[model samples]
Target chain A: MDEETAKMIADKGAWLCLQPFLDDEDAIPFPEGTPQRTKQLAMVAGTENAYRLAKKHNIKTAFGTDVLFDAELAAKQGKQLAKLQRWYTPFEVLKMATFNNAQLLKFCGPRDPYPGELGVIKEGALADMILVDGNPLQNLDLIIDPTKNFVLIMKDGKIYKNTIQFK
Target chain B: MLFLYGLLGRAQETAEKNTILIINATVFDGQNEKMQEGMSILVEGNKIAKIAKTINIPQTAQVVNAQGKVLMPGLIDAHAHPMFAGISQQAGLTSQDGYLNLVAAKTAEKFLMQGFTSLREASGNSISLKCAIDQGLYLGPRIYPTGPMISQTSGHADYRPSTSIPYDPNATLSYIERSGHALIADGVPEIIKGVRSVLRMGATQVKLGAGGGVASIYDPLDVTQYTFEELKAAVDVAETWNTYVMVHAYTPKAIQTSLGPG
Candidate 1:
């Protein structure tokens, strides 16, 4: 498609979901030079290209990690987002994961299960939120360990967790 | 002394209201370039009522001084398999459904505590687990279940014993297959039926084993599993139901074959 068309869709909030960590060398446990490993390398290159193109065209982007099979690896999802810092600023990565992804979910139309607004802190928005102990924009590494960094979690306006006393 | 006690009683009465006010928080707002500090957020009945540098606190609102904590939106996992529960493949064959469900329940809560508010189930037996959480029978993230992974005989999802004959009416399903975790289907018609069965079981998406897997006992890493016709049939059924099909494939050829002309 033309740049003009790309910009038009981006302006309306089209999202390009990027998962750089999926292509990391450690992602595939196969031996080096194996067909599976080589394929993973190609996949990584493809992902990098897609990221470059999205950035060049100013397409709206979102963070994603297609982690499956291993629960241990899946728990490290935050690290996947931090890996994006290699090609993007921490602030940009954070925004893509939150606001941009939220906008993308709106494309689900009537199939969207959560009807209320999400991915932001504003009046009338759904209160599905988290409280981090440290500023992630300044130190994205803090997000890598949710247990230590995330002090509180609130979903649907109900407090699921609160480490600090709040009476 | 009597007037002071009465005033204290009134204050306690106000605190009983369900409103919460969080102040002195370094709010991320999930979209802003810079973190806004010393902000106050008002939560009323499960929705953000107001957010500003200063908010009027009601007499009954429970106020929390955040001490400059970073506040942002809850995280999301686009691909997850909460039902897998880290159990060994051999153990999976022997474990009872009730035991497996319990493990899934624990796994789901752990995900929520880790700040994942929502997840998309990649495969496994997650339909009932999703229902349990949605119905308030258990605590978990908002799940988008795929039900089971569909595979051709000896494909990536095939966890059957090597001796088990394919498409034998007299033979019973393997424990993994009998557990609603996966389906072994071959040919275009079987693939279509498999896709439709999952859709009927509350699946929002379909997962097809379109390539060889490292864990498969029979298929090699380079082999493509389902034919284009079989893949197309699965996709067509998914499309008819307003959903999409996701395939498990790694190599270039396997991935290309899945995407070919379908």
Candidate 2:
């Protein structure tokens, strides 16, 4: 079935999810003008290799934060990815971690049936919200360190945690 | 002071150690290596410390000559239904439910006698049977167990007559009482819930019916019961629980559709 699908698409002169193999040792190509591709890399935060490949292939990539639970390793990868021009913004990264993933899995629309003005937090939306202390928009690191910015969290009309600190 | 003196004195008085010597035996080490030529094996305490070509007899040593026997590492049967009663269940012979533990214990012993020192039981008599065997409450092979086979409704495990409702309460419990298994739910949500329940109950691997079965009245032999989305849901549940999902499949369509591109 995979081969059949691949052949059908290839016969039409279109390829989904193109993975590039390069002969050059150091150079990774920048794919032009939103190159049509998607990449799913597992153990994403565990290795910088996937990021290097993602940049080379010009594919949009998403990662779960499970890799690099080791604090030192996470910092190392964070530093390495910062040098790349195609590196994802922290908010874009968070979107990939949350909403982009939900989109890929088709989880947030009519089939999901909980649309609140297009998932970007409009008023009169079903407020299934996560409130973190610091700003996740500033850095993905804020997610792992709740004490730095997260003051409270409410979900479905319940206060699971309210860690407001008055200075 | 008296107790300490007595203990020291007792330790100083040496008792003779008994020796056991077995000669002329073929031995197979657990690591798949074999030895021949009737070497004598010596055991002191629980360990086999000495193996020699020849040993002069000590008067105190117990000697036995095994001239014609083969000794292999205890075999471990990876999958066995120890409580399955060996019944071709269609015959309807009183349903193996009577004295299930006793039967399972005996079955475990039979497995041991067949040189299986370890057994991975998929689904069986009950948790009690496995617990008994594992806790040394009974003499049987060491068993790593799954509590019951979790089945999706009207799938391969919808083991009920067409006349009854799919969730016939009496029939469901009766099946468990008889076969030690259960048919859980029908759709994706129910299937995921059932998988979670089984995993929480200590099933290391969740068994799913990806295809129809010989006994299933819901679909025919070639028909696929689970959709790709449902299979993904099941896989997600299994993944979150840190276990594997083993789907029961008999047809290519079932395997292909359920496991395609996942």
Candidate 3:
């Protein structure tokens, strides 16, 4: 492992995007003895290895989920993020998803449809953001169930959700 | 009618008050590593006005006491089929447009209530549904609609009966196809035309069935669909419209074939 090369890539603002939650062992529909099962196992190993390498080299990381075909699974995206708790600290995972991912999106350059700054809050940054009910840094699992934990959601300065009405 | 109108007008007047102050909350703020405890957020109109431990709360502004609750961003579903309602393919052949739209609307509301603020419609006809939501005629999440799933004959998107002949004028279009849910195109010209038609209908992206599926009657899971030339035509049309194509493929061969043309 080329530690210098990994550090160079990190310095160049490259992000190691990982989706460990996509490696759902139980979701493999194939029979246990089938070749498809073997392939699924290999995929799980690959995902774990990628995460390990990124962490070992202190590489910049980003979070995403490649959910498709199943609506039930699609709604479990937050659970997928929580699954990362097996490998990372809650704060590290949150930073990877928010700060690191936003930095990577900037690489889109001209193709970036959203011109405003994202994934952060500042005086002039984009108003797209969220507010959770629990301290996620202490308990990452709180993010797994958004309906119960997410008390407020604001996008582009508008409050789309507010469970506790002040009126 | 006059009395009802007056009540609604008053309700709208109150709902239009956009200043909101959320206080005594633990703020995630999306990007920050540390959570700010006992913070206050002031939203003026649709934008966040201020976030501090203290802010001058306007008398007219709505004030929400967070009580140390966690506040975060709404979730986003990257791949969602809001139009699908779990009916059998054969049953879909008999379903009407009204029934399908109602089902889609219900699904959309479910998504919104579940805290999903945005959805990327994967492989269904949802442009009209998206429009209805955007126009405030329906309550749902923001949608990035893919008009329809394009597939080759006997591909994953091919939900037609086995007895139906290919491109036969005597045989009417399948309910799914007629309802703008999927299109079966065999050749490059047909693929290009189908892609363009969907793009014209305000599709932000194109979804093509580039592989077989378990639910599909004819195509086996291993079989690859859509030749390189055919896939290229769809890609070309999508690129012309400043969008991209997403192919539904499980097998490596199908994925590789789809990647070949792009």
Q: Output the better candidate (1/3) by DockQ.
A: 1
Docking class of 3: acceptable
Scored by lDDT, the top model is 1
Residue pairs of candidate 1 with colliding backbone atoms: B14-B60
Q: Which residue runs of candidate 3 sit more than 4 Å off their true CA positions?
A: A1-130, A153-161, A165-167, B1-9, B85-94, B166-170
TM-score quality measure for candidate 3: 0.74
Query: lDDT per model, in order?
Result: 0.74, 0.44, 0.68
lDDT of 1 at A96: 72
How far in Å is the alpha carbon of A129 misplaced in model 1?
0.6
Segments of candidate 1 deviating more than 4 angstroms: A1-75, A100-109, B1-18, B256-262
Worst 10 residues of 3 chain B by lDDT: B85-94
What tens-digit string does per-residue lDDT give for candidate 3 at A1-167? 13444455455544444566444642524457665455556555556656776688777766655443344654566777788888898877776666555665444344343455665555455555566666888898887787888776665555667776664
Error in Å for residue B203 of model 1: 1.6
TM-score of predicted chain B versus true chain B for each candidate: 0.84, 0.67, 0.89
